[model samples]
Target: MIENIPLLVTNISYGVTFIITVGFGLAVYLKSSRKTAHIMFLFLSLAIGIFQICHVFGINVVDGESSRSIFTGSLSVIFVICFTIHWVLAVLEKDSEKIKTIVGFYTVAVGLVVFYLINPSAFLLNSVPKLYLPNYYEAGNYYWLMFVFFTVGALYAFYTLAHAYRIADPAHKNKLRYFMAAIAIGFPLGSTAFFLALNINIDPIYSTLFSIYIIPLAYGTLRYDVMDIKVVTKKAVSYALIIAGIGFFIAGINWADTLIQSVYTWVPIWAIPLTSSILAVFIGGFVWEKMRDIDILKYEFVTVVTHKFRTPLTRIKWASEMLKKLIPVESADQSRLAVDEIDNANGLLVELTDMLVSLRQVDDINYLYSFEESDMCKIVEKAARNMNKHILDKKIDFSLVCADNIPSVMLDARRMQFALQIVIENAVIYTPEEGRVSVSVTQENGKVVVSIIDTGIGISKEDIDHIFTKFFRSKEAKTTDTEGMGIGLFMAHQIIERHDGDMSVSSDGIGHGSMFKIEVPKA
Candidate 1:
């Protein structure tokens, strides 16, 4: 009704472009890449989108009652100013906060224009909607304030883009040159339509129609992997397909009713349930792609478990051979030497076995802890005895001190001992040669406390943040000669947490040593 048949196609194109602008802009903003870049892009997209929406608005927005087309004319002028400023800021990588301030100013300016349009009788800006072709065609207010906002937006954008282009990176300059060219050509051509709409009695539809030239630049922005619009289209198609299928079935049922109204008048009611069931079945079946691949975890699992089994089994074999050679030994010193060596090798085998056993435990989300009513002193002594060979070999000065009032605790004996062994082994592995590693247990404020303090190459600030994270090692430890599979601390954290105990780290950065304080409930 507003123009030739071409205007109808142009209106649809505007709808698509506006939707794309909003969707792409939102993805970039939420993604963790560049907060400044994505946020500026969002502002630019929103401004352009507001203008596009107004260009397609009809008198029916007010139910054909309002005389003035406030949306069509006013929003168009404001869109030019806001869109240009945002586009320039986005291109230049301007300070995000400063650009946001400009956005607030532009929004306030545009709102004033729209406010004056509806209340021309009581304001500085006048509202006037002129009819060029009777009820079929109409044009809205020619407010001067509205045009001022538009000119300001255009000039701001021009300056923004020009300043940004001069400082762009070499890689960015080449890829962005086309988008720059598009802006150079598109904004001027688009702005010309706004100026013409103000003074002349020309068809206003061509203004929106000419704005489609900016799509080339939009495509460039979206295709650069910065915008994740592909994911949106994937979901959108699924919704459309489902709706189309239901619509077809409904149409078929209505046809059946009319064809046999006398014979089967109740067919439409039955079609409702059938349509719902079809939709339910389709959606339930379509979510397989959204499920995680799981292959990455599976690959890491095989690698970890394989190394865990091999290390301990090799130690056990060598330990067994040493015990055989020790039978009917030559000297008193040789026999003592053989026994200590055998203890060291067997200790490694037990640790390796515990390490393997932990892999299976980790897969079980909930395993009841085999809590035994145990003496606090005995638990500490058993752990110390199990780790004696490691202490002597690493020359770590280990000690245990239990308070007189330290209550007996309900603990899983083997698991708790295994937990202590892991922390001790790690401390020995990392501590500088001859640097002391001490294990002490005591009761404090009605809680069992186990402290393992080591003068080791300490954790860095960044490493401590993710030290308990799976398969992660401190950068210093990774670079050092320390041989670790990176699973000991993770398993220890899980075991401690399962027992309602807590573990924490205290480090003075790099060369400064670390301390682990473990606190669990005492029975």
Candidate 2:
């Protein structure tokens, strides 16, 4: 046992440092605002972290050789399987091919798990406890087959990423580059531990090389926002805590189960109950925090919806009162005015209800609008005209520039018009009185571009990033218009994207003005 001290220390230090770095990476990943490709990455990190903890325990803490072998064999295979899945997903966009890859990986993962359980010794043979840190293992016949499978998977992943990098759009290419660079350098350097499987007796010195991957991973997450993951604050913290809980549980379960042969040899019976009580407190706190977060989000959604409802209800009440008073007057003009007022109020109520319903079920749109191939320039013109009231009220200098012979596009005309109207209305609302708002449409390279430029209180740099997020209102916009629900841009952005187009915003700075740009493929 004395001879194993250095090995114990080395494995403990390596395992602890690796886990901590992975934990930090998980935190950064959870903070992302757009979680597209991030779910796979999260699972990969989690698997590696689990494998490390189990590996360290197998080497230094577990009493029996078979127990240690069982732990390492099961976890190592799982780690490789997750890495393979993450690799395929990170490179491919969501498509039928991606589904195939997922299915293939899952099959392989399940097979490996079954094989390891049936006979862990088949994958992990006799282990030689040594004075040196690296242990010697007798090679199993199936070991090389697993090694070759992983090697091929890693190579295929690199090739797929390279091919994707060559064909990706300019906006996405840089993200692929960052991911590729990290994987290329990190995975091989970290895979050095596999040498032990061949009875090669390689030290775990290169184990920490796995941590280097976190550097580029973080840079991509923070600098490029590559994965487009949205991590709400409360949810992120809760998930982080839960993941940590899981990690502790996995590491502690075996120790607790085989308490007599392991660390519990020195402990008294009373200590077990004390430890259990402490764990219960932690579990209780995690559950309570998650519940509180859910409650907060629910409260916020209800409050905003209630406020929006009140505006239209107030207008309807006023219209009803007017109709009641005018019934006795017997004047045609007064009756006509009351009828028009009621009609307008009903329209507003319908609009508000549709908006809320659409938001709730954004994926379904059959009731929203009819789709057809139509002149996009005409749509832009109509949308701009609908916002004429707000524009004239603000007395803003506005111009609409349209290129001749513009191409037609497939769209739900009324929905697209409503989307564009929302943007233009926002431009008018945010602009100061007498400020300029420019609406321009042009055809370029098989796409039609519509831009709305406004010299208003511009969005702050930080706010511009989240401008299209649901229920997000910038501080500057809030001061200007308290009645705005901050969902207009979100709705508009969603509509534009649903039509296979894109919408983006740019601003120089506050007081410097801003621009909302849209692009759609021509029909």
lDDT by residue (92-191, candidate 1, tens digit) is 5454646575668666776775676566532222223433311112223535555566556566665655566688644345546666676666665665
lDDT of 2 at 232: 37
Off by over 4 Å in 1: 1-267, 282-366
Which candidate achieves the best lDDT against the true structure? 2
TM-score of each model, paired residue for residue: 0.45, 0.63
Worst lDDT window (10 residues) for model 2? 224-233
lDDT of each: 0.60, 0.68
Tell me the deviation in Å of residue 114 in model 2: 4.1
Q: Candidate 1 has what TM-score?
A: 0.45
Predicted structure 1: lDDT = 0.60
